[model samples]
Target: MTAGPRRRGPARTVLVALPLAVFATVGVLAPILAPADPTANDLAASLLPPSAEHLLGTDQLGRDQLSRIIHGARISLAVTAAVLAISVTVGVVAGTTAGYAGGFVDRIVSRVIDMAVSLPGMLVALAVIGVRGPGVENLVIAMSLWAWAPYARIARARVTGLRASPHLDALRLLGAGPVRIICRHLLPPALAPCLVYASTDVGAIVLGVATLSFLGLGIPPPQAEWGQMLVEGRPHLASAWWLAYPPGLAITAVVFASNLLGERLAVGDERPSILRWVLPGRLRVRGGRALAARVTGVPATIATTSAGDGTLLRVRNLSVAYPRGSEHRRVVADVSYDVPRGKILAIVGESGSGKTTSALASFGLLDPSAVVTGSAMWEAGAAARQLVGLTPRERRQINGRRVGVVFQDSLAALNPLRSVGAHVDEAVRNAGNPGQRTAIRRVSEDLLHLAGLPDPATVTRQFPHQLSGGMRQRVQIAIAIAGEPELLVADEPTSALDVTVQARLLDLLARLRDELGMAMIIVSHDLAVVTRLADNVAVMYAGRIVESGPLDAVIGNPDHPYTRGLLDAVPRPGTVPGTRFRTMPGRTGAGPDDTTGCAFAPRCPDVVPECAHQQPRLLALTSLPAHRSACPRQQSDGPALAAETARDPDGV
Candidate 1:
């Protein structure tokens, strides 16, 4: 399951991290470590320059330069720490809130951040410091006040991007609240960059503080600070070179240390692989373990499970719409469905039929601009639950364990840079299982086999870009089924494959259902494909289910005219030459001002005057139980009149 080159503890990391850690620790103990009192004056040593008694000679005030520089370490570290703490805290909170709260809130927050950024930070800090006198607390406050706005802006931008990210959206649909979604899924990824920014800022901030103090507007006199010493020694540069050089060198060293540490930490984390041994054994082993966990199970969603129900997943009256210049255009309307433990209920539809939107809304996948006013329920297997109104963490509990998805596009789904095995392993850990190297590889191989891929070992080692389209789809299937999920929602899994490959994939799906008893929901425009695979069928048009029922009954005796038209349009081979095929009249389009009776009325062949005056309700026709049609004239039209109904297109 290992991917590419493994991450190792670089020589540079140790070189930087160790020294900075040592420096910071020593700075904390500076008051005790200095040989002479940092503030005490000696008249004899004053203006005497460097000597055995005074390693760095004395300042104009007769203070030992060496002692003062050592003591100054305490102030520098404190200011750096204070600025980091204040700015990071303020930035993370404000950025995430504004990012998640899109539209007017986002606009307003972004504008304020922009305004702050446009102003010169040093100038602002100077103004604030001018009002407040020179002191440790005042210096820290001044730097932080100017520094925090940038952090906030960065955090907000990340949150804005992550709020719409697939992972966060998945958590949201699982009933996660805004706070949990931001904190768990959104925050961790954002923190890596934030940390790097904070580290780099420390050097600039320390310099700023020093610059202020040197100007006599920083720490007060007699404080034994480096900046104050620099100011006092300026007049004696020709007579005494030792006093100024020592403190300047110390400042330069600390700044360099800060830069080095920040760069090492910036590397953050990388996926584990066989090559990771290039790193120290401990990190390599840990990474291997983590990769193993990912391949074996579902990735843990940042959702909670305390709100009980084995409800697993649910959606009720979920409607979504896009805003035009002045009006809202509906995309998903009054859609609802639920999946219990170990069952798959397919939502079938064509492009723009709202199949994807319905799926997304079930897990909160829409943009924040889209208005959502429905409850999605979630119940872990054998656990009672409410999917809607539950926090994002709660919903996350079911994402990998109970619900997994396989999209139509496989290549776009998996990461291009990662190997198939490592990709699978990532999911295993995300599900919170034990991550061991051997275990992950074994699980990854098993998943490949389960997906009906040949030569599991060879395939697992290959990157996504190296695989064929069908093979990529198999990998996607492996990922979706990695957690041994209770429900698998496959959106046109075989659509992209040729007929031969499609048949094989369908067989694999059927086997999974028979062997695992996992529930399935497959959306497709191919009725013949659905007829063979699905136990029940749903026909969707214009963002609504026009008809739905058991597969046989729906195909044999479709109650909806739309379904009949679709069946008439299916290509049948071996027909005579020059024969014209049946085609559904009118193109699919949604006008902003459209307020017609039925959405499909413009396209329906059996459109009557009444059909254009009122919307149809889903009602039972004189058909088998569980079969329903959303049409005004169903049972009223007898079977003898079926031939005249909609003219059956042109020819069979």
Candidate 2:
């Protein structure tokens, strides 16, 4: 059954690809294929008419028209190939250099291209030929000089547009040099259009060479070139018309065929002929069917292997790093945690502290540039799966079905074009419950109602813009729970909402957690929100979890100086009017070149000399074994640490 499409692919490719192959072969083997010497002339047979003895008859010089036409293919094709090579090479290098370098270099190159493009191609060719004198070599050189400008403009525009791609920025963050980035990332996408342009240019180049030859400037006379043949036949046109028509017709056919092939390449129709069928994997039609079958089939069930003590997900020694010159900067360093079923574990940190990075790593959603080292064991229903090294396809099978995520911005997460119901319907389909149309609709409404929307039916019919901020967030939660995933990772779910809305949304999440019995990972910088929702809290600083324990213990009895600072910075209700709000003493940022010692040492209020010299390891408190702090001076009493506050030098 699959062989039908596979068989047809080669036939379509051959139909489009055959003419170019035949033309190139005949041109390359002109000497062997020609019936007679193309340059030889016999006065006795001058202008002989078409007959069985001499096909295409004789030119004005009595040379065989068929042989001259065949040999002309060699010259035209050779010059066209040379022009393509020289023009494309020079244009690509100059254009990519200018676009990637930008600023001064871009301005200079753009002006040069403008000036070059302003000059007429024919006039520039004429001036070059005038200086160097006319010949096949000079003609090629002159054509290349003008031909490269167009390709340069095309390549420059393409590179300029792609300079800001996120993939390229990620490469830069990974320590890739400018040369490597331009060559590997910028050049490939720019090459497609340049190649298409080169294809179409072949016909123009052939026409130029012939025009020069007809004007008595190219290939001299007895070469039996098509253009020279045309010139020779013009004077004898009144008496013998066959002499002019054959060469003209041959030139027309070759140019038209080249153009036809160029158009096919531009439109992406020239597929790999026999290779399409021989290599079954490359066939899209076959691959699509196979993918559809796999998606629809019963999902592979996993055996639930406990990480220990009923933990739903266990992450051990999780670290994420990006390259910096010769070394790597760890963003999340040796972080470990566990979330039991129906429990909320909040990862709290300021921006760039690696809270989100660590959360994403557990789900195998980190970028390719990040080097993640650790194990994220997810216990799903009856089976346990390791998420760190799963292939993308394998990860896809579990992501929406076993683990769902509600991103920070509801507006960005919900497609503006799609209705609220459409988003939920997609999640329902992804959960492998793609039932009949009516059933899918009912399931979508049920999921929305479960997410706490008052009118699930009305909300389902509205677009993302038609809903309020809280409603959009509710829709997002509805989509997240549509799959009934065992674990839900909410990254700053209520950060964008007003205080009233934020409180309502938090309550909705708590209700959902209880009703669904799903493990939840709440990622937030807001400690108040974390206090209200999280059963356990992990405080992060400079990519490492500086302190972690039960919520009341970590917040009421803070241990690490950084954690203490964060708690002090939060605003409380009893503060007098006109008083300045507390702020952390130092700014926050992280990079691969972090010092060997503690990352938060510079910002620590009670920093000691040893804090800058030795990196602290997260160790369990002797008093509370489950509670851990990375500080060497681990105070036994949380109330004592919380009582002490450092006075800021710059008071507002």
Candidate 3:
């Protein structure tokens, strides 16, 4: 179910392509390759066995069996290809249109597809073929009528799911039309599964055509069709086995090959070659180790640092960068924060603000392509461990067991194929508790209940897709808490839900935090959510923290201009109907290649000339202890920073 690219090896390629190549060659060259006229009769050579002169011998009336089989491939392949083209084309177009343009059109199309699929496909094909008498053209038309129903169903389902995808919304915002969105975004990924289905359908279609011909309702006698040939050789089964065997073997081989090819292509098993088994386990391990090291680098081990008082997790001088040609592009720069035990620290920022990057780096979750330089020290009892320097194996020991993460989209984070119980069970196993396997169900139910799921039993049995957005999120929380983690990271957990659901989920998280007494970090762009949940808040711009303090100190009296602009931008109930919403003057200054100056200088409303020359260090405020802002012009407070009482002063 992952959308990641599949790797195909040479063995798999050969497995899929070689059979197809043989069939295609035979079909294309039937006329040129036949040795003798398939319809030519010779009473003397009738019922002959396979011989060098006639090769697969002669059928009744002296027709060359080899010639007939070769020509038969042409008939079967051509008809099947035509039927598939028509069916797939009609299905894809109808399904895509209906799915993209929902409501009336979708309902109408869904009903029609349901009706068509409900009626037996073979029965419908038989009825049509019976009404239109034998002939290859009529036969193809009969099969295509129901063939399209399956394709339409598949296409509709795929498109319906993709319509809700965040990527499609991004495309719409970029001004892409419906046609472009369908072709560029929807069709490409959907086509893969459809292609797999179509491949498997080939063998079935071939068999159906052959069955019709054998019944004397398809390609007539002397035409040299495989099914007709089978009928002719039936009476001479004992005396002349060659007449039936050749065509039967031909049909069997082609169908078998088609099915095998489809299976290999669908699964994308890269190590299909037997040579893999021949290699020694030690050599294979060495090779894999070398490859992993080359790609991801060996995990560095940093010595433990002294822990600060009451700080459960402390991050210092954190910077994350990715390789760009010979140099590196920093995404997060010199970020620092500390999470006190049993408290919430919210990192609030705009989209490109590097809040999420810094959080991910603290947990060692970022990819190896990113070079993270920092000291993320976590206090465990009397000892402290440097998370940034731990090996992947070492990190795994604490990740699910001591630290848990809830991602933005619950649907994307949870496996669609797995039941909620299975997800929780895996988490329990990972925790490595004694007798966990035996008590998995009980433990999972308890976790679900703790996460506030109404019917734990029902939810445990249901898959992620079956649940609503809020329910899926609750299930995700259950999974995260199954390990009884000490530190929980909720990364925009309620962003996708409606206001009512968001509030409920936030309340649930707050309750969990208080009950478990776990240290938590909330990464978000929504200031309302942050103020409601976080005790301390850090405002990030570009890749660095511009302000940090208690939520009340920061929101009640914002020091940085960027933070003030953000507060003003929030829509309030008292704003005049015709007035425009307040917005920052310019966009974020973060980019792959940027100048060495204050990142918010380009957008700052009261930008001083000195702002563009150098970046300011985070300095403490005289008014509030532990309150800091990265601004040189602290004496000049803009009008926008003035308190507005009419706004929803109660935090979101």
Best by TM-score: 1
Determine which window of 10 residues in candidate 1 has minimal summed lDDT: 299-308
Top lDDT: which candidate number?
3
| By TM-score: ranked, best first | 1, 3, 2
Off by over 4 Å in 1: 1-68, 95-130, 153-199, 221-223, 254-347, 352-485, 493-508, 540-581, 587-652
Question: What C-alpha lDDT does candidate 2 achieve relative to the native structure?
Answer: 0.75
Give a tens-digit lDDT track for model 3, residues 1-652: 3433343354556766566567678879988999988788999998888889988888779888899888898888888898888888788777877788789999999999999889987788889988998788898899899888888888888889877775455345324568877775565445556666787788888888888889888787778888888999999999999988888887787788779767765676532232233321121111111100122121111002122339888888888999989989998887888898778999998998998887878777666677889788897668988988677678777788788888777777765544688778667666664343335566677677777787888898788889999888888787777666777898888887999999999998897676667778999998889878998999998888899999999999998998998888777778888898778977886552354667788888878876776666666666764777888576344322223212312111
- Poorest stretch of ten by lDDT in candidate 2: 286-295
The model with the greater lDDT, 1 or 3, is 3
RMSD of 2: 12.8
Model 3 poorest ten-residue lDDT run: 283-292
Of the two candidates 2 and 3, the one with more favorable lDDT, higher being better, is 3
Please give the CA lDDT of all the candidate structures: 0.69, 0.75, 0.76
> What's the CA RMSD for each of the models?
8.9, 12.8, 16.7
